[model samples]
Each structure stands twice: as structure tokens, then as C-alpha cells.
Target: MSQANEKTDWLHALLLYGLGFLLFWEWLRPLSIISDTGQSEIFILFTAFLFLLSYFQLPFWLSFPVKGIAMVYALHEMFFPGSFFDFLWLNYFLSDFSQNVGFLFDGRFDSLSNVFRTFLFFILLWLISYLMQYWLIQTRRIFLFLLVTIVYISVIDTFTTYEADQAIIRIVIIGFILLGLLQILRIQEQEGVSFSKGRFPVYWLMPLVVVIAFSSLFGYIAPKAEPQWPDPVPFLKKTTGDDGEGKNGNGISKIGYGEDDSQLGGPFVMDDTSVFTAQIKDRGYWRVETKDVYTGKGWESSVRDRVMFEGSTETLFEDDVEVEAFDMKMNMTGNEEFDFIVHPGQVTSIETGKDVQLLENPLTGKVFTQNLGESVVLDNYNLEYESPTFSEKMLREASTEYPERLADTYLQLPETLPERVGALAEEITSEEDNPYDKARAIENYFVGNGFVYETTDVAVPGENDDYVDQFLFETQLGYCDNFSSSMTVLLRSLGIPARWVKGFTEGEFVAAAGDYREYEVTNNNAHSWVEAYFPEVGWVPFEPTRGFSNQADFVSDYSDDEASNTETSDPAQAEEEQAQQQEQLPQEEAASGSSSAPFEWSMWYTVVLIVIFLLLCYVVLKNYKKWLKRLIISKYKKRDDDKALSEAYFRLLWLLDLHGIKRGANQTLREYAVQVDQKLRTKDMKELTRRYEENYYRGKTNNDGWDEMKKLWENLIKKMQS
Candidate 1:
């Protein structure tokens, strides 16, 4: 073999083994490194072996599609969590720009840019590989080797973060292999290694078999799928002296109820995952709002609704329920559509609440709702959920009949306030309108003004009675919490029934399989909006924070297109500026735009595929000419008979073993055949045994013996099928 031929010969095998190992390594690593154990390690080893076997039979090119699909699915699950899978297809095409896309709500193009950029990057890399291979075929140099290695290492480290799951790791590994192959191809071309079409070899089947076997093994042994589920309850809110009934070290109360733990609010720990989930007929605030009278450690829900028994009436335990003109009904059924029912606090009455018959649960309060067809009366005398859970009375009640608790909260306001803040509120909203209109006007003012939205870093809360004044007049930026709190207090100061409501904004719905729409809620998605009570209109929500008004009419004022276009233009414009500077100087060298070192085909499979493809093409286009030249020049080009016999013997033995025939480790070919015939149960086995004997013991010199032996194996296959 020529020097060039020898140089590129090892690339295929080297890449195949390297990628197979990488796939296994990635699979062994768990989401959290702390979870890694012996089980994952053993599985990885087995999987790698299976892959090796599968690749031995299949073409390197064919294995990529299956692997690529699997990798993409796994990686997407790891990074984006809830929202990640919804836009998975975007990731496939826009890998390069994924990091810079920002949040979905930030801007549309900002999100999509990464995905598109990644896809473009991959394409460019592919093109580079093609060019590099074309160039490298003519020359090989030491600098080339070092450059290739350095580039490969840099690419892997830069793109493959620890958080990336097994699938993405596989992609990275496979990509490297493909690039490496192109480099090898380039080297081969440069070294002037020449070969005739007839001499070209095809090992596509070897890798194909190995990859298939590996994938199958992985699937069979893979662990059961586990869907992410929320913890049953939010982090325990308080660790008071443990009451004997309580399990934790806190003695506050036997029953875990009333308010969240009080020792220290865990900014990290979340509320009960299920707290936000309830089935309601209509969308509204989840009445977590509790503050008997704001004690200033942040407003909290003080009263706990007693859980009513199944099919009980609200009349049983009503102190007094607020009456309304129109009977309101809310129901909590099983985990169906709209799993959680959330409403404004101070809900004095219940009617048409489903599955809740009003029987009381001693522990959790107000668990059930009164079931009154479409309308139930609020026990106005007692003011329990629509008094008389099953009364036939058609009495019209005023919507303003609120419980004392509700009235007290609405009327509540901080004792101290900056004079300028109150003046500003009054100035923004005229006194001619009702409290509801005033509240709306104030909300509109805050949203319309130059107040910014973001979580504030401020620690001082009691600086002024009018927190809104401080925010508006002093600090300009605060998160949704700050914005909503300021608005709530201001509305209360103005005699409007305003309260802070905590819930998440609706996330984009992902219509996955069937009619199910998966909702992905994140910490970034948690939000607070202000609810202002109008005597006639009931309670209405208003988000006062700029760029995030809760009103439906509040459209995004920021332009996504402009933001993305401007961000994308910065680099291009900079390059253009540089080019202009260079243009002014007559003798200056033209500016070269930034170009990444081209990716060479590093994958063994891809290299193997390219090699096979080139071989096949050569065989088709120049086989006859090559054959003539070989016949006239090197007569030894034909494979050696001895080598062919050894190959045929080993192949036939492996084929027999595949059919369930056992072969002893130390048995020779002739000995194995004799053993096969003695144990043979069918004519096909006997024939196979005879063929092996003829090829091995009889020294059959006919060049066609290998062909005959192959025919016997085919017959055996047919017999097995029959």
C-alpha cells in the first residue's frame, strides 16, 4: 500500500469505536451527577457492545437518522423542561442561535434566531467538511493533524455542556466522527493515494449491523419512562414547637393547615405543586389572599376554609355568607379539565359547587362545595356558601353584600404615606367616578407611566406609608410583586376594593398527543396581578407593571422584529464598518469576514459512508477500466486463495452459531463440522456440515467453492424459514 493509502486507512475503524464509546458514556451519566451509580455504568457497557455488533453489519450513513432523532428528543427534555419539548422541532433546525433567543415572551425572533443559527451553522460545517476533504486528499502535514485535534477538542467543550443529556452527547460524538472523516479524506487526497474502482472496498454492512444491535439492546434494557411530577405540598411554611400530632419537629398545630410555614419563606422551596391546580367553571384568582389586617410581614391568608363533607349543605356551618343578586356556582370534581377552582378571597357563599355536599372534614376546611344545580343561595343569615345548599328560593341579592373580613381588607391602608404620592393618585384619577373607576384609572396611570418591570433588589419596605409613592417618585424599577403591592395599597387608600392576587399567567399551550394540552409553568412564569372590586362589576384584574398589564387590551408595545433585527445587525455592521475603513486605504488589505475553521468529517460512519459511496461510484463508472489495468499490471490483485478459505471458514462458522448451533472454543473447522453433523436435527444442517467439511478437510481448490459454500448457508436459511 502507498503512504497516502496507509495514512487514511485507520480513520474509519477509529471513528466508529470512538463514537460508540461516547454514546455509552453519555447514557451512563445521570441528570444530576449525584445520582450516578454502578447500575448506569453496567448498562452503558452492555449498550456499547450491542452497538458495536450492530454497526458491524449496517452502513455508517444509515445509522445517523435513528441516532439523531433519539439524541434530539433526549437533549430537549433536559434543558427546556416544560417549554423545551413544545418547540423541539425548532431546536433541530436552529441549534446555533438557541442560546441567544431569550425568553419566549421577550421577543419572537430572539427565541427563533438561535434555532435558525444552529441549523445554518451545521450546514456550513458540512460544507466545510466537503471542501476540506477535497483539499486534504492531495497533501498531509503535521500542522494539519495538530490543527484538527485542537479544533475537535474546542468544538466538543464549547457545545457539550454537562447538562446536555445522552441524546445530545451522541449527536456531538457523531458530529465529531463525521468531521474527522472529512479530514482524513482530505489527507488521503493530498497524499496522492490512488486506487482503481475494482479495488475499492465496501464495509457499510459492518457498521450498520453493530448500530442496530446496540440500539435494540438499549431499548430493551432502558429504564421505564418517568414523567416529572410536582411535590405533594409546598415547602412546609412554619416550624413552630411541634404539636404531638404533627410529624415534623414543629409543635405549631397537629394539622398542617391555615398558612404556609412562617420561620423563613424559602425563596427556593415552592408552594404545594397542587395548590395552583383546581377545577373552576370560570378563571379567577385562587383565594390564597389572606390578611386579617395586613400585619406588614407581607399580606398572607389567615383564615382557612373548612373542608365540607361529600354532599353536605353549606347551611350546616354558616356564620353568614355574602348574598349576591345572581347565584354563583363553582365545582371541584376529579382531576379533569380545570383541575383547580380559584376565586377572590371573602367568598362567603357557595352554590352549584359540584361533588361538594357540604359535609365537614375536621382537618382541612371548606374542601367541598354546595351542589345546587346552577344556583345556590348564599346563607345570608349565616352567610355560608349560598345559604341553604338546596333552597328553592329565588331571592335577588346585592353584589355588595361582602363579609366584614372582606370590607375590613378593602378599607385597610398603611398609616403613613408620602403626601406627594396621594396627590399623584388623586391627580391621576378624578373623584367624579366610583371607586372601581378610580381604581382602574390609577392602574392605567401606573402602567402608562414610565414604571419599569423587574424583580427589585430593594430591601427597605417601610420607608413610606405610600409604597407606590416611593416606587414612582424614587425607585423606578421593581418586579411584578412590587408593582402589584404598590397598586393594591394605592387603590385601598382611594377607597377602592383592591387586593393583591398571586397566580401564574397562562403559559403557551402545547397541543401534544390527542386533545391534551400540556402547560409549562416556570419560576419565571409566577406572577402577581391586582384585583379591584367594583360593586356592580364584581372584582376585575389589572396588572400595573409596565410591559405586563393584566388587561386583555394591553398589547406588547415592544417590537420583537426590531429587537432581533438590531441584535443580529451588530456584528454584520461592525464587519461592514471595518471593511469600509480598509476600503479607504488604497494599499490596505481587504478585510476578511470572521470565518470559523471549517469542520472536517470526523465521524467514522460518515467517513466510512463517503468511502463506500466513492467506491461504489468508482466501481460503476470505472470498474472495467480498472479491472483491465489490474489484469495487465498486478496479477496478484485477486484475493489470495488461502486467505479466502480462512475467511469463508470463519464466516460459515459464525453463521452456523447464529442459527443456534454450538461450537466449542478449541474445536478446529473439521472437528466442529463432525460435531454439527452428529448433533444435526435436519437435512439443512447436515448439508451445512458437509460443505464445511469439503472446504476445510477436503482442500477443495475450485475458486467457486466459496460461492458454493455461501449457497449452502442460503439453503440452510430457507430451510429454517420453512
Candidate 2:
């Protein structure tokens, strides 16, 4: 029996420590701090230290006093020192706290806010340890209940809210916690001091291991819960370039125009972090990167590493007889690690003033800088590209004779692509004869149709449905990715080679830096479009997404047969009409411009949580004695319901304690009640006391006297308040 009790005691202590650690896990995502940060480990180590002191059983007399001393020591070191009771007057702590509270209302996630929230998190974690210890000493199932909360927070932080690392270790911790809880349940269910040898064998843990193994396997294999609207509150944010020491990936790439690999219509939140500044001649599509292969889920570039350009100068689009030479000088100012921006037209040569290298992926036409170990300051570079000018005759003679090696890759479509997609493409382009006409027909279909463009509230395709099919037929509204990806799929269904392209649209031009016009390129300027591969012409950019112009001089005089009648008959006429269209953006749907919001209402959620926490603290402090009395009464009620009058007398003592009327335990019940009434300066509780004494001492049972006793209790309560 003693051994069994000893084992149970040890297990409960371990459970308390584990539960407190898990409570700290909730902050892992929100604080955006990892174990390696050394900041998060500070709190974790202190919490463990406090838990170690009370591992066997909390010394009720010393625990709170010890914690108070620790708090005083911490406060003195953090905010004040060499003074007693000066912390109450320390305006620095209060001012920062108040400012952070205001910032929460203003919807800002600043570092100061994180500091205040961390302080509150530590306090709440300490409370969890205290409560768990109390429950452990009583042999209650509360440890198991708290275990569920830990699991809930774990799932939210790791799977839903934040992409937490150390996944295997987290799973192992949870598995051990489950086994401990099960062992506790087993011990709790036993009847006698001894186990009767019916106790669970040590080998019973094999089943728990199996359960955890299968659970982890299923977690890996299962389709994630893609809610139509996921929980909108973000766990962490990439508001500034300096967040989390610049390590956290905010669902979007920090490397400007470098990569975007998320599924189409899958939601993400980005910040207004300034990625770069490009000096350009015009506000056209600034092509950064292109993707060749089209996966049913999204797009990728297997051909990216193939085309490498190390030389300083190279001519592009040499086969075309007629082209306009576009020469521009630019400087790289952002993301020193990555220096790549959209340069209009086919890049011919780059003349950098310093030692620099450019690697090109010919298949995708994506030029990336190899700035390995080189600090890329505002490195000045001059680039010249031949922007092809296509007339009706030039594009008409262009062939679909795609390179044999490239043909198979570009025309590739997932077998899962819906058959209706091909059929719909044929129907939309039925009036068109050539490939360019068909491509124009598809672009016109998107532009003329009543398809709305929205970034938020996007609905992802069903598990089995194709992304393009769902976008075209069911949800005919999306951002540049949706429009471009669907157009790419439709063009490919007809053997017209196309791929997804991503970069920035010509951003808001801010000022003239030296001789060039400088444009501020933010995350909002991140864009996606389509590149239709023409045999002699190579890959040409097309803005299938409405409200944006061509990135690679895509405006040709050759119009679709259906559009020729409605559109201008010449390039000069087309440019005039485009000017009118740009002016009409305000009157028409500016859906393209209103694509994304950098921040959301997530900070409001954090503020509300803090508000509720403060409210709870206020309640606890305001009625400390009443809460303590309720806790004691609950235990007594659980142990013996026949001692209702004794519970009532304990409540009276707590009430007297609240008024500072301390009565000795040797005082009679009548003496204590009288002292409590006199301290209150109101009606006495003499009859209530007499009835409670009769029921407690005489072992009297009266079912009818309960209502009169309740009346006396209410009167006493009112008298105390008065």
C-alpha cells in the first residue's frame, strides 16, 4: 500500500510539471520565439525551477511566500533596485503596460506588446502549476482534464496557427503525457491500498506505443482540414523585416519574387514590408520569375536550374527581325541576400559597376543573381532588352513547333485535370482560328465575363476537383494566381504551351532617384500571370488577369476574330482605348487593385483575450475570501454532504475573515457569529448561527428547516454588504 501510494505521488508530481510545460507551449507560436532563441528558454527554465521546489508536495506555508520573494527579486532587478515598496510607484512598468494595452486596441503587434504578453503568460503558467498541485494532492482527475487543454493548444499552435518545428519531439512529449495520464487513471480507479495484482502490467505500455505510432502515421497521411474560412487570428506576423530576427517565414517568401509554392486559393496573410525599389522607364509588368511545369495543385519549375547566365552581356530574342531596344539602369536596395527584380522585355545584357553574376533559367526565363557571400549594397547595374513588337503578320506566321524536349514538359497537364476544362476552352475559342487567336479568346473570355476578383473569402476546390476547373466553372473569382493558373491550364488543354509566371506589377512610382524613376515595390505588388510559348517568338507574357497591362510587350495588333470588331483596328487605336480603360478603373471594378490586405483583425483577438484575463484577475482579487470559502466548501461537500451546517459555519468564518474579525478556533460558533455581526455594523446572524450549531453538534436532520436557514444566510449576506 505504501509503495502504491508512493508511485502515485511521484506520477502526479511529474504530471504537474508536464502540464505546466505544455501550458508554456501555447506561447511558442505567439511569441514567435523558439527554444534556440534563449529568450523563451528563460521562462521555461524558471517555470521548471518553481515546479522542482514543490515536486513532492507543496509547502502550503512557504510556497506563496517563496514566489513572492522571487517576484520581488525579479522586479527589483528588472525595474527597480535597492528600495522596498518602490515598485508600486515605478511609473516605467505601468506606462509601458498602458501603452501596450493601447497599441493592442490600435491593432499593432509590436515588441513591447510581446513583452507584456509574456509577463502575463508566465503568471498564468504559474497558476496552472499551483492548481495542478492542489488537484494532485487530492487525487482528482483534473490533471487529465488540463492535459486536454495542453493538447488543444498544441494542435492550434503547431498545425493551424504556426508552423512549429521540433515536431517529432513534440509528438514524443504528448505520447508520454498520455501514458502518464492513463497510469494515473488506473491508480485512481483502484479500490484498496494494494493493487490485488489486477494492476496494469508494465508491458501494457506497448499498446500505448502502438496507439501513438498509428496516430502519428495517420496525422502524416491525413488530408489537412481546409476550412472555407480558417481561424482568422494569426499566431505571429512578419510586420517588419526585423521580426523574430528575420527567421520566421510569414506564409510568403521574404526573398522578393523568388518563390511562391502554396496551393491556389489557399489563404495567407502578408505584411506591408517593403521588398525592393526598382528604377524603371514605364509602369509595365516587371517580370521576376516564371514556372514551367503545371501541377494540378499549383505550378513549379523543374527547368529553373538549367539555364545559367554567368556572363555580363547576352542578346535575347535575336531571331525576331523587328524589336524595340529598351535600356534601363537600376539599383538594388532591399533584401541584400537576394537581388532580383522584374525588368521589362527580354533581357539582353547587364553592366554592373561591381563584380556580379546572373543565372538564367531559359525554360522559365527567370534570371536570378548569385550573390554568394557578397554584400549586395545598392549595386548599380545597367540592363538592355529587346521588347518585341508583334504586328498581325508577325504573330500569324509564328509556329507551334515547340522544342521536342520542352514540348513534352510545357504541354504536360495532370491526369486529374477535369475533361470539362478542355471542352470549355474549345467552346470559348470556337470562333478563333490560330493559336494566338485562341489565346486572345481565352483572355477576352476572362475579361468580358462577369467573373469577380477577390482575394479574401476564396473557396478552394474540392479534394477530387481540379483547381482550374473549379476556378473557371464554379468559383469564377480569384487573385492573379487563380486567373493566371486557370488561363494556363485552358491554353495547355489545346496544346498551346503555357506556364505560370510570378513577379511584381509596376508598383507605385515614388520619386526620381538620380536619372531614373524609383518605384516602391511592396509585398502587395507581388503578382502572377501567364507566359504563352510561341515557337519563333519564345515565351511571351500575357496579362490574362484583368486590370493589368502586359509584362513583356504583350500588346499586339493581332486581335481575336471576335474581338477585332469591338477593339481598335490599329495599335495606335488600341493604346488610346487602353488609356480610357485605365481612367475608368474607378467607375469599373478595380478588383485587381484591391487584392490583399497586409494585416487583419488578429491583434484585436489578442486584445480581447487580455481583457478577459484582466477581468478574471479583478474578480479574484475583489472576492478573495469568498472564492477561498467556495473552494473549501466544495471539498467538504464532496467528502460528506451531511455536514451542510458545518460548511455554512466555515462560510461564516471566511466572511468574518474578510472583515478582519479573526476569531480563535476555541471560540464557540455563537461567539464567532456575534463578532462577525458586530464588525459588520448591521443586523446580527444569531439565529442563523444557532440553527447551524444545532444541525452540526446535535447531528439533527431537518429537510424543512433548510429554507429558513437559507433566508437567514441571505439576510447575513445583505447585512455584511451594508
User: For every model shown, what is its TM-score relative to the native structure?
Assistant: 0.35, 0.43
Backbone clash count, each prediction separately: 111, 1
**What lDDT does the true structure give each of the candidates?**
0.42, 0.59
Off by over 4 Å in 1: 1-164, 167-175, 185-292, 295-297, 301-408, 416-424, 430-434, 446-480, 503-527, 535-538, 545-722
lDDT of 2 by residue, 1-722 (tens): 44566565566457655654564454443332211121344455446545655563435675676555554344333223224456653565567679888877887754343335555666775786666555544454454554665565556555343454444445455645555655655565674333343443335456666677677777777788776864434334333433432112323222234465545554344434576676665446666666777667677777545345754222334366457666786655554335553576667677776665566666566666556634344355777766665554555567877778757877889888889999999999898778877887787677635464545334565567677877788767566888999888999999888878787777666665444566677766778888777766666566677555553433334346532443433343355346544543332223224433233222235435534554565456556755555565454433434455556656766666665678887988678767777766654477777887677567677443444576566556545531
Error of 2 at 599 (Å): 35
Question: Residue 721: error of model 2 in Å?
Answer: 62
Per-residue lDDT value at 521 in model 1: 32
Candidate 2's error at 158, in angstroms?
A: 20
lDDT of 1 by residue, 1-722 (tens): 34344433544444544543453344345412222121233334333433443433334465445334433433333222233347754554354444444543476553343224333433443343333333333342224433454454444434333344434535443544444444544544678654543232334334644565576557657896774864322222323432232222222111112334222111111221222222222222233232323333245444555454443222221223222222232332212222223332334554432343443323222333345523222221111222111111111121445556557866675555556656777787765354544655676665434454433123234423334555667655555656777777777666666666665553322223222222333333456677655443344456675545332211111244432221111232233333433332222111222243233322234435644664564355434543433342233224446555456455545555655677888976557666665544445455656665676678887355655655555444333210
* lDDT assessment of candidate 2: 0.59
- Looking at model 1, which ten-residue stretch has the lowest summed lDDT? 387-396
